[model samples]
Structure formats: C-alpha cells, structure tokens
Target chain A: GAGVSQSPSNKVTEKGKDVELRCDPISGHTALYWYRQRLGQGLEFLIYFQGNSAPDKSGLPSDRFSAERTGESVSTLTIQRTQQEDSAVYLCASSLARVPYNEQFFGPGTRLTVL
Target chain B: AQSVAQPEDQVNVAEGNPLTVKCTYSVSGNPYLFWYVQYPNRGLQFLLKYITGDNLVKGSYGFEAEFNKSQTSFHLKKPSALVSDSALYFCAVKRDDKIIFGKGTRLHILP
Candidate 1:
C-alpha cells in the first residue's frame, strides 16, 4: 500500500518468549521511527533509523528491546524475554527525512499482548 | 527538555459551532508544533503543523491551528464542528530532533 504497513496486527505471546515486529515504510521514505503506546498513555519514542547511519536507539526502554533497518528500507523491532509490561501497541512511522518539519506517515501498528 | 501539554482530557462541542482544543509546549529552541488526530483503532493522521510561516496554519479536514509564540501555545480550531470530527487529538513539539507528544485530548461533537 502507499502508507506504512506493519505485520501481525495483533500478537499474543507467553511471558519470557521472544517476538519480532516488522515495519514496511512508504516507498522512498528515508527515515523510520518506532514508538510504543501504553493504555491511556501518550506515545513513547522507541528508536529512529535514518538512512544507513547508526540508528538513534536512545529511546529504547531496555537492553531487551532492539531494532535494525536494512539499507534504509524495511525495519524490524525485536523484543527478547518479553514481559507483561511489554504489552502495548507498537507503532511504526516514516518520513522523507529527519527534519522537524517533515510530516510522518504512520502504520496501523501491532498490538502485542504478553501474558 | 522538550514537552507538550494538552490541559483538557476531553472537549465537548455542539454541531456547527466553533471548536477549540488547547495545547501548550516547551522546547529549548524554536518550537516545531503539530497536531494529529486518531480515529477508533487506527493510527494517527496528520492534521496541521507550524514551521516558520504564518502563525495560523491550515491543514486537512478543514482544521486549522494558530501558533502563539508569546503564549507558548498551538491550539487547534475549526469553524464548524462535525460529528465525524470526534476523535483523539494529540499535540506535539520538536526539540533537539526529538518529537514529543502530549497526553492527548478527546473531542466529542454532539449531534
């Protein structure tokens, strides 16, 4: 589709398991971002991938959360040893670039339920 | 640090009447403001943004926002409210290349 797309719209996993979320950004977009939204809370920045340079992983919650982008294209967010606290809607967004003025297009998101 | 605030958790308005959703922000440098709306079980849709042009920025769905640098506010406004306009609204501010969002405000348009 023209907009950003995320796989496994909903996922339920057992505690201590591992899960991966995928994101396909809009065609030609040079920047990608990952964010998590907890119930009744605002969006929390997770990571940002800009071109081929090192991703901005500053917002990652913990060491268990890691993400990688393949040549400025599709990106995947991996969660190791999933915990109940990890349950949330993981959102993916993409933009033309990292400029503040750039408008980001968001994907439907994957709702992860770690029980 | 950079942050955005939407004071009201929800705002109720009558159909055809003017509406306003308040938003305030703080950042280290010149602020980059934005408004996004989300419908049920859907991702946020971009509404309007304030970069460097006029204080009032018009966006999709006939929505508009005014950037008040002196007041540190960027309030979303619409001349006529529609029931379809009811949704969750988020205000954001960009600082140091990070875009921070507010808690969000839920708008309900009474028919």
Candidate 2:
C-alpha cells in the first residue's frame, strides 16, 4: 500500500483476555513506531524499530505490552491481561530512511476498548 | 526525559481569521520540532517540521510553524481559518528514535 495500514480498526476485549494489533508500514521504509493515545492525554511512545537495530522499548508502559516487527515490513503489538487503562487508540507510523528530518506516515489506527 | 507542552486546551477563532497554536519543548540535544493535526476518529497527520536551517517551516494545508531556539517553542500558524480547519492539533519533539507529543489543543473555527 502507498501508506501505512492497521488492522482490527476496533477491538473490544475482556479484562483477562489478550489482544494483538497489526501494522503494515509503507514498503521499504526503515523506521516504524508505535504510540498509544489515551483519553484526554497525548500520544505516548510505545516502541520504535529502525531497520536491523534493536527495537527501543523504553516507552512501553508495562511488561504485559510487547511488539515485534519482521524485516521492516509488518509489525504486531500484543497486550496481555487487558486492563481498563489499556483502552485507547494504538497508532503506527513509518518514515522513509529514519533520518533526522523525515516525517512519518501514519495509519488509521487500531482502537482497543477493554471491558 | 524529553517533553512537549501545549499550554492551551482549546483555541477559538473566527472563519477567515488568522490562527495560532502554541507549542513548547524541552529536550537534551538539538530539537526536531513537528506539528500534526488530527480529525475526529482519525490518526494524526504530519503538518510541518523544523529540522535545521530556517526557523520558518511551511507544511501541508497552508500551515506554517516557527522554531525558536531560545524560547524552545515551535508554534503552528495559519493566515486564515476555515470551518473545515477545526480539529485537534499536536506539537511534538523528536528525541532519539521517539517523538514526545504535547497534550494537544482543540482548534475551533467559528462561522
């Protein structure tokens, strides 16, 4: 696709259930990022993947949250034991070359609602 | 830690009037400032960025932002506002591989 795409546009999960959100970045883009937008709050960085380098997980809120990207193509974000606080929109973005000035292309986002 | 701040929760402007959304940042190294806009039920779209040379950066949708190093601000501006321009605006600063975003400001364009 010409732009970044995300799957499961909306998800409703139980408190104890686990969920996975998917992201397909722009073809050949080297940098992919995940962020969470909570109600009444800003976009919080989740994780970042730049090519073959180690994915930066510093912004991840907890151990239950994890994400993986394969060969700069598709990425999946998994959350275990879904909590009410985890309900938010998960956004994904990708940039052309991971350079300093490059702007990111964003997906429509996956809205997760935990019940 | 890197941080971004949008002091105003909402800004209202009349249609055809000029508008400005203020943003400020705190980062360790040089700042890579950016502005993004979000329509309801949609993801954020990049507006413009200030990476280096010029302090004034123009972006999509006739939006422009000025970068001030001393004040650490990257304020987004538009010469005219339209009813369709009403949306949420976010200011961000890139630190390392991640970008820190402000709380966002809701722009209301009154007719």
What is the Cα-based TM-score of model 1? 0.97
Candidate 2 per-residue lDDT, tens place, A26-67, comes to: 998999999999888889999999999999999899999999
In TM-score terms, candidate 2 sits at 0.96
User: What fraction of correct interface contacts does each candidate retain?
Assistant: 0.55, 0.76
Which 10-residue window of candidate 2 chain A scores lowest in summed lDDT? A96-105
lDDT of 2: 0.91
Q: Which candidate is the best by lDDT?
A: 1
Model 2 residue B75 distance off true place after TM-score fit, in angstroms? 0.8
Clashes by residue pair, model 1: none
Q: Tens-digit lDDT track for model 2 on B1-111?
A: 548899999999999999999998998788898899999877789998888889999999999999989998899999999999899999988877677889899999999
DockQ per model, Cα: 0.75, 0.76
Worst 10 residues of 1 chain B by lDDT: B94-103
Docking band of candidate 1: medium
